[model samples]
Target: MDVSMARILVLTALAFAISGWAAEEKPMLFSPVSEEPEWRLLDSGQGRFTRQEFENRLGKIFDPTGAMQPYLLFDDGGVTLFRDKARTRPLYRLTFVPEGGAGEVNPPLLGGGDPARPLAGKVICLDPGHIGGDWADIEERTFRIGNDAPVVEGELNLRTSRRLAQTLEASGAKVVWTHDGFEPTTTLRPADLYPEAISYLLQGSLGARLPKYSANRLIRWNAELLFYRSAEIQARARRVNEELRPDLTLCIHYNAAPWPGGRVRLTSANGLVVFAHGSYTAEELAFDDQKFHLLRKLLENSTPVELGVGQAIGEQFQKQWGFRPENYEGSGYSHASGAGPYVWYRNLIANRMFDGPVVFVEGPYMNDRNIYPWIQAGEYEGVRVFAGKSRGNLFREYANQVAAGVIDYFRRQAESSATFTNYSP
Candidate 1:
């Protein structure tokens, strides 16, 4: 053969060898094609999740905090796959797909039902955000403005939880409480967890370790975690994963905007947001088990379910309190599951550790100029001039909204025949 022809033949053979080697080394996660960029089978569906679906439903498709290794790309050939487009030669593979064929259908949202008794035969867990009442100061949930009954997020959230439980029970749903009152549920006391807490406070700096007697941010942070932070999170997660294996968990918390200049003033910002998992971080992926767990969650097709439920609850919030859905500006905050507008992706411990579905609810800013007075007014039942109808007063309205949301979620699930097992990781 001619010299040029021989060189061309050699190059073609080399290309085939490289492609074959890549296919052997890095197997596809879901696709059947050989070394082709195709969709990762997150869930068994007729087609892959389209980019339009990601943009219109979830606002964004990529995780900003980490590499977009798993890009959901679709083609005209009815093939879908998650590809790590960052690499010089991307790897697309199929890792998981459900047994059933109808995996692409979105979980249904809560619909209208009986007012007196809506949720029946549903098991719900109400996780009040923080230890409230006497421990409000300890949890750092107290915001005092001239000492007028300090705005306590824990107390407000607890009140909301209690009322929500009552409403749920009245409607015939079994309710589990992560925290009954101000008492913490953590197995280890703050002092017992002091060593680990101190390590975290020191931020992994061996030389920067604070003396036990030193009064510094490290010391303060250590104390805070012991009382109601890292340790507290562990305790709460234990309740959800072990003790209370309810169908779903509602993590209730009142939000507060940061005040610049170290000053605390009431702002007019009033709105609401809710979250469900699905933005796995690099830190979480470092652990082998958690990495597997995160992958399982994604593969099991739970994101759509969580987003659907989150959006259902968001709708109820809008209806009852006129709260607007949140639109964040950053990475995880902006990414969603194409199920709802308000359902943003976050890597919270509760969202990460809890085995079951968790809905993290962030209500109106407690210190909003309009909301401050309602917060201080104390709990009451019946309508008032400013607050309107009071089921158990204005604070209870938080519970009312939540209860309504949960009921709405279940009601829709029942209507759509979406079982919990379908989305369980």
Candidate 2:
């Protein structure tokens, strides 16, 4: 054989060996089924923002704690992200738009219709929290006060979403649902997640890490938690990011205070809060999936939209329920959104996983002594006296305010579309 041919053969063999080594040494990811970050997915954002714009966003919304500093290297033209704090392995390089320059033109707006339909051509995805029917007990989202009827949060969320969907559709927005009924979005049951649960337990990062049961029972218990909390949400995220691809996604949930000493009971505490993603703890930033998402959300320009819709929703809550914001002041995982007292920035799993803007609404406190009676009354018609004031059923009231808030946001977006340009999105 010729020397040139021999050299080419040797180079080809070396390339294959390197490829095999890289493929076999897969990085540890958050979920057992989670695919590694597809770095190239962010290519659309190339030259979409300036360094100043990126830095302002990072300081104002994402990465407030500067946890990303360890993994990121920035230059005049772009940034390089690494998988580890030592920055030995590079993940992706993102170029910035030159200062005082315009980015590539964004795609045309989706809807141009009659003034009457402000939401025309908008796609909204509504997620009704959890599985409430047969799985409520397993999911532990149901509670009972004495002989009174059980208050199931998942069921409540579904009821609220159905109403909200109708309201949004009436305004000319196309509505999609993550799950319409009690069925879980995920097919993986607790048994299927046992191994993942074991791996999670070994990390000792999840809740219930301390021994609360026998070794076998502890692992089994965590498996159940993983199934509902992680796997189920991941499934819904797949739908949101791929199939639904909604302009905005809403995660509707009813809040409950911690049941102390494993005793489920009512409390005097009551509060309301709206969430838009932000506030990454150091621990969360350590993972590559989290690092990827933080950048994706930043470059997607979801924070502005998230905050805008969140503010409108906060107003509705004040006008309707008059509840104070749930104070997360000392909570390490949350930060004040600066939009209002009722809206805060929190990095929740659903918000992190789903692409685009997300508005997470935490409804009334089900465990509040005042709310327990309202819940017991069930999803009834018209108004009834509650806490010395006539009020609509809790579900109806929740739905109305949420629907109103969404409509308000879209109306404003429509009015401002002529002037507003989202360079990153």
TM-score of each: 0.69, 0.89
Candidate 2 residues 189-281, lDDT tens each? 999987676566555534433545666666677788888888899999999998999988999999988886668877777899999998888
**Model 1 bad stretches (over 4 Å):** 1-118, 201-217, 282-293, 331-334, 387-392, 418-425
Question: Residue 208 of candidate 2: its Cα lDDT?
Answer: 37
Alpha carbon lDDT of each predicted model: 0.61, 0.82
lDDT of 2 at 43: 89
TM-score of candidate 1 versus the correct structure, residues matched by position: 0.69
| Residue 413, model 2, lDDT | 61
Report RMSD (Å) for each prediction in the order shown.
13.8, 9.5
Model 1, span 1-425: residue lDDT tens: 24553454456447657767353454332111112222342344334434333333322322445533334443433323332343233323332223333334353333234434557656788888988777677676878898697788888888888888898898778899888887877765555654445334333322234444433444455556555765676667777867888767788898987675569888767877788776655444333333334443443444555676688877777777776676774553345555556678776666655656778888878887777787777875565655443333566777777777777766665654433435443
